[model samples]
Target: MNILCVCGNGIGTSVLLKVNVESVAADLGVDVNVTTSDAGSAKGTANMNDLVLTSAELAPELEGT
Candidate 1:
């Protein structure tokens, strides 16, 4: 699975979330590729991702994906 973890800055919370997600995916024996991005850039870059992780405010933007 391709997962994109997004935050306002793309360097702090998004990186932390990516690490946690990878750990959980490992524990579950799931193969996943996680990437991080800022909310503004995520929409343009998320086309390759299968799932998106972001704050509630950003969720609706990804709904159509």
Candidate 2:
């Protein structure tokens, strides 16, 4: 499975969430690839992942992906 964590800056919250998600996935024995992206970068790329995580404000931006 693939996961994409999105945020405005891509260096702080998204990165932290990526680590936490990975840790939890590891504990559950799920091998998944995780990615971190900002709003702009995620536009065309979000559809490639199985899931996307982001704040409510940013969530709409990823709509229809």
Candidate 3:
């Protein structure tokens, strides 16, 4: 599975989410390829990933992406 963790700048928040996602997927014994991306970049890359995770503040912008 490919999972994307997105944030405003693609640095801090996204990176943190990526780590947490990886940890939980590990605990669940699910193999996943997780990555971090910014809101703008995510818009273009979202389709390439299986899942896109982000904060509520950014959710609307990413909807249907």
Per-prediction TM-score to the true structure, in the order listed: 0.87, 0.96, 0.95
TM-score quality measure for candidate 2 = 0.96
lDDT for each of the candidates? 0.90, 0.95, 0.95
Off by over 4 Å in 2: none
Model 2 over residues 1-65: C-alpha lDDT tens digits?
99999999888999999999999999999999999998889988999999999999999899999
Residue lDDT tens for model 1, 1-65: 99999998899999999999999999999999999999888978887888889989777876665
**lDDT tens digits by residue: candidate 3, 1-65:** 99999999999999999999999999999999999999999999998999999999999989888
Model 3 residue runs over 4 Å out of place are none
Q: Choose 1 or 3, whichever is better by TM-score.
A: 3
User: For model 1, what is the C-alpha lDDT against the true structure?
Assistant: 0.90
Model 2, position 64: C-alpha lDDT score: 97
Candidate topping TM-score? 2
Worst 10 residues of 3 by lDDT: 56-65
| RMSD (CA, Å), each prediction | 1.4, 0.6, 0.7
Give per-residue lDDT, candidate 3, residue 37. 94
